[model samples]
Target: MIFAVVGPSGAGKDTLLSGALAARPDLRLVRRVITRPTKAGGEDFEGVTEAEFQTRLAQGAFALTWDAHGLRYAIPHDQINGPQDVVFNGSRAALPEAVRVFPDLRVIVVTAPDAVLAARLAARGRETVSDIATRLSRAAFTLPDGIAATTVVNDSTAAEGISRLLAALQPVRA
Candidate 1:
């Protein structure tokens, strides 16, 4: 089973994912390859330069790739096509392609209110007020039609959010 964990920025996708991975050791988390440097530091990703990313893409090292925020993101071929119940932080813009690639892929959508999102994004300090404003504006984006997605509203405490996430992913235990 492949579960694509997706959400708007500051929805606590990483925090919840980290907690879920720690709680469920059997799940495989795909560490993405990004065009950003490792020091950019949000998620644990394989930071590569744009040239290297293009080269790897040309070499068919990825099963999936997408560009967002002016950066390239990829999921290694072996990582997705392999036999394992995998999970990864995925993007909304890439979900349609991802669905085509992994037909059985499940979409887990994590989300929160605008006020909560604003607060969290502010706390991160990675974005300026204007940048966060833009993010919040785009946060209301709707998922592609016909995609079966499970929405988990991560509006409360971390423990509550993790519990909700764990419940949503419980079928993976099978």
Candidate 2:
């Protein structure tokens, strides 16, 4: 099983994912390979320059790759096989590929009220007001048409969110 966590910026998707990861030892988190300078708080997974990423892509070093928000992300095919469930804090562009590759894929979209998002961004103090406003202005994306079984509206605290995810992962008994 693979779980994809997605949401707009300032939606606390990362916070929720990280919390769930800490609690779930059985869950294997897949780190994304990137072609951008590592940000302060991000996990650096084989960072490379844009040219190098392109070269590697041409060499078939990536399973699926996509460019979004001026950054590139890739997932090597070998890193994903296993019975252990996986979790990803992936973008909207990556979700489809994830679902295609993993048979029992679950896509969870975390969201908060616009005002709540704005306040969370402000509290971070890393993003300028303009940056926050720009992000807030971007229209939120709905689940892709191809992926119908989406779980939406995760507005609870991080702990609560993790509990919800754990429950979602459990097998449904008839």
Candidate 3:
């Protein structure tokens, strides 16, 4: 089963993903092929320069890829081999291809109030208020309906958010 976790930047998506991985050993978390270095509070993954990423793409190394925040992110095709349970923290723009490729994939859209998201991003002190505002605007409308989509509002502590996420990810019984 494929599990795609996507949300806007500064929505605490990475934090929730990291916490969920730490809490659940049964799920294998996949690293994304990013065209930039790992950010603070984000997982360390194999990073490639834009040129290298292009070369790999030409070599058909990616299962799915999309550009966001002026950078490219991809998931290697090998990572989705078979029906192995997998989790990925990615951008919302990457969801459509993933759902199409992995029919049984489930998607989680982590979210937060615009104000809260802005505050959290500001606390990080890495982005300007205007930048945070733009991201929040994008996050508000990123959820798509075709895939099984679940939104977990991150207005509370990370622990609280993770609990909600875990509950959402649990298999539903018929």
The model with the greatest lDDT is 1
**lDDT tens string, model 2, 80-106?**
678888777777777777777675777
What ranking of all candidate models by lDDT puts the best one first?
A: 1, 3, 2
> Tell me, what's the RMSD of every candidate?
1.7, 2.3, 1.9
Residues 67-165 of candidate 1 have per-residue lDDT tens digits of: 999999999987765666799899999999999999989999999999999999999999999999999998887889989888999999999999999
Model 1 spans with C-alpha error above 4 angstroms: 81-83, 172-174
* Comparing 1 and 2 on lDDT, the stronger one: 1
- In the predicted model 1, the residue pairs found to clash are none
Whichever of 1 and 2 has more TM-score, that candidate is 1
TM-score of each: 0.95, 0.84, 0.90
The alpha-carbon deviation from the true structure for residue 120 of candidate 2, after best TM-score superposition, in angstroms, is: 1.9
**Candidate 3 C-alpha lDDT tens digits along 29-110:** 8878888866533576777899999999999999889898788888898876755578888767767777887788888888
10 residues in a row with least lDDT, candidate 1:
77-86
lDDT of each: 0.92, 0.74, 0.81
Positional deviation of residue 107's Cα in model 3 after best superposition, in angstroms? 0.7
- Mark the 10 consecutive residues where model 3 has the least summed lDDT: 37-46
lDDT of 3 at 151: 81
